[model samples]
Target: MIKERLISLDVFRGVTILFMIIVNNPGSWSFIYPPLKHADWNGCTPADLVFPFFIFIMGTAIPFAMPAKTFDNAAFNKIIVRSLRIFCLGLFLNFFSKIELFSLEGIPLLFGRLAITFGVSYALMGNFSLKVKTYLALSIFGILLFLAFSGIEEYREVRIPGVLQRIGIVYFFVSLLYLKTTQKTQLLTASVLLLVYWGIMALVPVPGIGTANFEINTNLAAWLDNELLPGHLWVYTKTWDPEGILSTIPAIASGISGLLIGQLLNRSLPQLEIIKKMVIGGLTITVLGIVWSTIFPINKSLWTSSYVLYTSGLAILCLTVLYYVIDVANYKRWSTLFLIWGVNPMIVFFFSGIIPKVLRMIEFKNPEITAKTINLQDYFYSSCIAPFFNNPMSASLVFAILNVILWSFILWLFYKNKLIFKV
Candidate 1:
């Protein structure tokens, strides 16, 4: 059996996963400082880099995790299984936000909505049910109808696309590209795609409008996202989407860059040499990113060219540091916590969404207060935990630290049992 272990990569992935949990599960979303906050519109933030870095790490691991040689039927099958499993897990996460599987209100409303919409649309069109074909048509029509008729209300918020959905779509396309093109060709393709996106965003004037200023409302990216993926699917801004279709172009490039790095690492270069190369490459890309920001600002929402380079460079630099300390120096002691996190990232992310919602649903009444009820999550954070901390920030940090510990223990159990839940 080929021993499938890249200590450095594992450490890098684990670190990124840990940060993702912290930034995502803040004790109070409202109380986060500027670094934790997502970019308002076109600028980059630390939080904004987290998701892309994770995706980049995913790409980096493909070489090790995937079959070593030819893309045979078995290899293809593995990819299909892994991709579908992750995609379903993401959809399930979304489902958890909607309904408790056993509760009265926990009906699979998303599926029900699709079923009803497709059934009606097909019945009206007098077409035989064609499974996914019918559902796809109906889903598109339903989204368009919602955009046209539904006002900007809470009900319509359900229609928007999301980060996981974007990841699914981008993964699908990038995998196809990987299969069709050579490694060098894929790199070229990524470069061209980024350049093309930059050109379109900068030069192509919106129809019936002429202005150089690319403000949130007036920019072509926002207009296209609104026109194509309208309604509540817009992320940060109602008029714009952070994971819009156009922005995904550079996001794929980010993944491709990771794949290239993966290819380099696969070549059996010296560990120290690899670290040196990574440092040099990362610093060069970072400098280019800074220079590019002069013209096209490093905007995370847009997934701007500069932002992609900057984040990719930083991600590589981080991986290099992890590589040096963990693999080269043989420092295995400190990596245990991150190893637990890396081994079960998907499970942790899924449960993070589920646990908070389940806790919030269960209410506890205080004896001293006149029937004052607190959400279970709040009770855990504010009552038992907050007293130990001096201030709100400290309390928040404690909550996040506890969350990490709780989830890390759960992951440790799986790791101890040698249970690797792929996809």
Candidate 2:
């Protein structure tokens, strides 16, 4: 198979992951720039674009990663394992949260118990059967369940869905579709799925909530989240999940869009033709999304159909620009910074999340503050960084930039060592 692997893919992925880290690790959520914040309920923001863009990029990589059109038992196992690993990583991230961390008096618990249980179980079950290993895994997760809803009311239930989880799921289904179907089939599937999602969300009346609506918690997606899995919901709003079930239907379409584009490049047409087609195609989808948004609305939280189209169109345009400049025009020096992150995105993403949570876990009593306590990360930000700026937003942004710099240094070291690992 002829594969058209462009360096711009890495640069684009790197750029997305960079913004993801910045937007997610703000020193204070209150001090975030408006562009960094997600849309309150409807509309898209710069922050909102990161996830779908990442998903889109992942779809583009699918053809390059797995060129074979055939699927076997081995393929099934590989997809399942990778998807689960990414999903579990997301769960690990969710398990370590600030609001849910504190148990009684600013003491973080839960994850430690789960980790120890897994370690001890694995150590003892060295010669166990597959069935026995399954049992052992269940026991470890059982501990997590017990700990999640065990104590204080302030500590919310553990979240089941997240950015990475959604990514994993999208990867799994999109990969399957890519292997099983032709380009025409994949495109048709994406279009049909989007239309079906639009219909379900618009026409069908939400049960228990009465009329069909897009209200925060009363929407059909929110109802399914609350009904299907009650306690295992996002902490932000217990009633609805941003990466909820129904929204994933449209989310799949976003990934398929990338899959189609990836195949488009595989044809290896002339450079001008590729650029011309991409611009026209991107604009067409974008205009459709805008027109559709008049009725259905382009909601980031809901992961609306229009959202899938809008984001996917922009992603195509963004990749086209990068492809032309970096690949066609031979501009390479400027994108070296992005390549560091692009080379080790999975590790960077995992550790970037882990570092913040680990820092939050290590708390020290504030010498000056009387009534409350602060985590190590927050304390450092407040005392060292926040002191310099009058605007809290600037201070928070600096802290975020520091996170980027710290990770960049780490990624640079990993790149220097060539220690890249994939799940």
Candidate 3:
């Protein structure tokens, strides 16, 4: 008999993806309430929990997705190729989102000098030598350097550290960690990583800055992110990029914890028993997370140890619930929406990123604000959609619901055609 796929995992992944899309695509960012509001600097919010929950789900699915037995060279090569493809796709998305290709005004002097130099050396250099490769490379590098030194200019904000990039890196490293390390070793390694990260953030004094506190000026995390990354690359704030190198360590731990759960679930246990264990485990972890938060502060920007535990615990609890509902109870109807979302997460995420830009390109005049125009997305949400609803929260929900329906339809089409695009 053909074995059945894990209904719980699919449902869990689907639910997580749905929340991710909803939380990300709010009706109006400016009008969001406290729950939706990202943790200001060093506190946990519902919004802060969403990304880690998704990452945790990714970890939970790993054991089921990856082969049980050891792999040969060919299998290893396939894994590497897949990982690289995912990573590169994320980078491509990043590149496309930013607009630093070329500026006619910024390079007038360089263009003039280049034209003169090329004119003088036309015969010696020929058409082949006159290729734009050198200019293009120099231009790209120059733009990056200029951006780095410019100190977070509004128009040049690239938001370098992003969800996709982090997901790519975390997925790649965590998978390797799983392959290389023993279960005990992986758990130990995760523990050491969390403690070490905490120590470094707490103790390390940044140059011209104090310890890594929540304060923007004094925090070492901000200092390191700003000093290390190009200034213009910061998405949320120019002073500190959220996806800094240091913060990623804890993020990986979140995934590792998920891997542990995956390992647990992979064992030949009864469905109801597993659900019970998961709920108990999740609750235990969550309690510990809350307790730890007293000391570590549960900061999402920092990706604090407490935050990781808390989010992971919540993720487990969520999985447990879904497992009970979908797998044990055999309730599959509601899950169809989430299944669609889980199946096409990367595509949906990429489209969400690009679609807003496309909408912004098609702007409508704002009669209330002189010389200011609102994008189609904003107009749709604020003018037409939001006004239909009585409250801001309701309107936001409506907007997110609409996106879910739209994306769900798209994914259903993909599913109908048996189109599963990995990586």
Candidate 4:
């Protein structure tokens, strides 16, 4: 078994997480830099690369992660459970905001069950004893359940298709492919999926609309999402979801791209040859993606076939450079920061999101403005940051930078103490 960890991969992962945090937590979304914002339609940007990059990295890690190639009942159960947990985590995020913290009007008895339950569960993700973790989680869960039954609240429709949910679905499918198939088979599967997706989008007629088209709302993927998920699509675009059902097929291919890379990385080949092959393959795939984009435009929202290939190729190229610099050439000095983030990504991601929501929850009346209150983020940005910068975009960027720095400091403490959150 190849048990040795790759420093470069960790650094790459850490870099992705760092950028993800920065882009996601901008002080003002309205004032974000072009590179930090997602493409509105059929194009790729630096911001667009983050999710697929992580997905590819995750796929590349799968071969090294699996305990056995042969599928046992235990292994199958473990995989399913892990995928479900990830999905649940995403679902939990959907519910996090809707859970009223201090609201007495609705579900007063069940005051912030999701937050309380999650806080207790998150605490258990540490290096605690199994018994302790289980007992505490169960205790919190029981309390939450009791409170939930005490008061019935109006239900809010949840956004099901999200980054984490897509990741979980991709992981499940790709992990199975990795475990069961040869490298050639995996590659074939990915190619077929991309081709199949392209075909479906190009040819298959949508249900309500007769012709198939890749419009923002009327596309086959979007239509299917609206049909199957209905009220569970993304909140931003109720008509369509970026991580919709049909799009997940190509997303699986993105993961498979990583799995193939994982297989290659694990092989007992010369380091120089590995790097050379990666560069060549990455560039070749990238060109193919670009060529194909002329026919089927590269859209991140649809998780288009071209977009998958484009992002996966870039991910490969990025990893190749990282591997050579950090691993082959033994220049790893600067990677320490990313390594801290890579190891405990889940903790940072979950809490980073929660922290912003927590800030919103902890809002107070603005003394300067009568009959108006402000959130922690808004107040901090306006009072401290916005006043300093002439450009609102600069201030927004600064706020995002500050967020990244805060996480770095927090993660450094975890790294120093060796307190890893396994989930």
Candidate 5:
């Protein structure tokens, strides 16, 4: 059996993370290519595949991280610590721009979020005669409760469902599911989850909206977000959340699909046999997804069941090719480039978000107009590329690609230094 982590998995994840940064930080949303932008509402795009791909990658990593031992104290402790660390980091990212440094709320808010997430996760991990962990967790919880009722009235949204938070939550459940079940049972559970989600969206009536539908704000998923989340929905769509509650069911399915493939890869089989199975299985799943989409629709925002299968299928196919070429055939020279981002995904993702915001914040007095100020990034783009390219779209693409190159260099340093930032 292969004892090491797959080089192809890391490369696949690196490729996914690279696209994620590019799509997310385009020079101008207005000037983005059609494929770079998310589909207006329903349907999938290259942009739509990144988040689920990350989630799928998370699923594949679980077995390597947790192993097949019973949920012992060590295992429990590891899961809680890692989940809290990741979740708190996410909360801090959401609060980074809004808080004031000297004010009580600034750095403390960041620490407080970390403490709260850590404490909650610790408490859930079972008491192992560790009073310090328990007390710390309680203290964090108490601080959060006080802050909730303090009525400080910040500009941030009430219930911001962050990308990292969703990943953490889905990861927790799916990883736990894998630990508790056999492979056969896991596959069945995933199928049931996808089917149940389909039934709910297709059969259940949306109150006041009448029948179940896939329309923009009229769908079951949107209604659940509006009703359950209320003021916490995505700022872009106050009425609905792309990573909303109801849609998470299918998202979990995407993770399970990856987990299934990961388990397959781990089996005692020849390399060519593994790759052949993945290619054939992926094509079959892809065809089934297409047929199901006739009724359910492969919507990325909604995370429809069809979308889960379709994306997972593509992910499997991609990984198969990468594994065969890079791992089996010993073609690993190019793998180093991808391994940089793949090894330090969270670090790349977090800094990618922070750097752009920092650049945008650093405004300079416009050279052309004394009273006007322009963002540093905008100035660089306008001067360096916009004038050269007649199409703003081309310039925007150049800016995004440049960001990727810059981040790739930064990640390469981390890879060289062996500075992977694991949750």
Candidate 6:
């Protein structure tokens, strides 16, 4: 197998991750530049492209990561374990700062408790029979069931579908799809999903809203969140989520587009010819997406079909530029900064959030005449960044840029140490 790592793809992923860190950790939300902020309801913005671009990178990287055309039992088991690990990591991050770290209110927790208890009890019992272990496990499970249902709400108010969770979910399905089907089939599947989502949004009659519409709160996606998700919407919105369930369908389509591109690159073609074809394909898809938006309206929150195409096309366009510059032209001088970020994308992203959250949680006496307390993050932003810029928006932008620069250095250290975390 002629396997080679694509420097262009790494740079692309690094750039996307960098932008993600910047937009997510603005110095002040209210003072953000318009381009950095997400589109309100029914449009696409640079901020909105980050997530889909990462998804597209995931899909594109899979073919390179797993070069096999078939899945055996061992491969399938590995896939399952990897998916679970990624999903569990996301769940761990979700509960990292939650009020309830562990509660015996769910069956999963109950079973987990039972297993631990049974192991301890069985050790004390001195080599218990299989029959005895079974009885003990069952007894513990029974006790857990009663405690689990004692305080039940009809609907869960909080949901934990973070960015990592969405990435994990999309990665699992798309990776499995790549294993099971050909590139032609993947393209067809993406088309079907996009068309189906478009049809659903256009035709489905949302209750109490009369005819279906694509407006912010009145859209079919928002309606589904209200009916199905209810209290489980985004904490900020409390009604709809940007990365809601139905929207994931098109997000997966975005990933599939990357998968198609990845597979295309595997073909034995001239480098210049491949780059030219990619540019042309990306342009065509982008145009189609813009035309489709006339009817569907490309909304980031909805993860509308047209938005997927547009974002995916943009991703491809960006990738082609990187490929042409770095690969075709053999330009490697200035790619190191992004390459460092690319090597440790997951770790940088995780710590980017964790460090900010930790800093925000740590309060100190305000270094001012008045008696006041402020989080370290706010203090640093005000002292280090805000005073320099007359415009608050410029300060906010600088703060975000500083965050990107800070992470680049941190990731550089990890790259030097070879401490990259993949999942």
Question: What are the TM-scores, per candidate, against the unseen true structure?
Answer: 0.81, 0.88, 0.82, 0.91, 0.88, 0.85
Clashing pairs in 3: none
At residue 47, candidate 6 shows an lDDT of 95
The candidate scoring highest on lDDT is 4
Q: How far is candidate 2 from the true structure (C-alpha RMSD, Å)?
A: 4.3
* Residue 123 alpha-carbon offset, candidate 6, angstroms: 25
Off by over 4 Å in 3: 1-4, 100-157, 212-214, 364-372
lDDT of 5 by residue, 1-423 (tens): 534687888999999999998899888888999889998876888998899889888898777665563777766665555555455445445554544444654335556444543444444333444445434444543444344345556533544566776786777777777777888988898899999999999999999899999889999999998887676677788999888899988888888888888888888899899899999988988888889999999998888999998888888888889989998998989778888889888777665766676677667798878899988888888888889888899999989999889898888887888777665
Q: Which lDDT tens digits does candidate 4 get at residues 1-423?
A: 364678888899999999999889888999999999999999998999999999999998887778457787766765665565555566566667656555453334234654464674465454555455445544543443344344436323566677877887898888888777788899999999999999999999988888989888988999989887776678888888988899999999999988888888888899999899999989988888999999899999989899998999999999999999999999999889999999988788677766787676667778679699887778888899999999999999999999999899999999999978764
Order of the predicted models by lDDT, top scorer first: 4, 2, 5, 6, 3, 1
Error of 4 at 125 (Å): 3.7
Q: Give the number of the best model, judged by TM-score.
A: 4
- Give candidate 2 misplaced runs (Cα > 4 Å): 97-156
What does candidate 2's lDDT look like per residue over 1-423, in tens digits? 467466899899999999998999888998999999989888999999999999999999998888766799767766765675566566656765533433533432536634542454233234454445445444544555566567645334677788878988999999999988888899999999999988888878998778888778888989998987687788777888999889999999999999988887776689879888889989999889998999989998888889999999999999999989998899889998898888778777666877776677667667787667678898999899999999999999999999899889989998899877565
Q: Given candidate 6, what's the lDDT at residue 412?
A: 87
Model 4 lowest lDDT segment of ten: 147-156
lDDT of 1 by residue, 7-67 (tens): 7777777787777777777677666657767887667788888888877887777666653
* Candidate 6 lDDT tens digits, 348-398: 655565567557656768888349888889999989889998999999988
State the lDDT of candidate 3 residue by residue for 1-423, as single tens digits.
112367777767777777777777888776676776788777777888778987897877676777553566755554554454444444434544343434533345334434533342222222332234234323443554465346645335555567766886788777777777778988898889889988887788778855456555467777777777655446557787677778889999999989888877777888778777888889998998899888888888778888898999998988887877877788888777678667667666655765665566566678669699877788788777987877888788788778878878888998888775555
Clash count list over all predictions: 1, 0, 0, 0, 0, 0
- In candidate 4 the C-alpha lDDT for residue 417 amounts to 100
**Whole-model Cα lDDT per candidate?**
0.69, 0.81, 0.70, 0.82, 0.77, 0.77
Better of 1 and 3 by lDDT: 3
Better of 1 and 5 by lDDT: 5
- Choose 3 or 4, whichever is better by TM-score: 4
Error of 5 at 378 (Å): 2.2
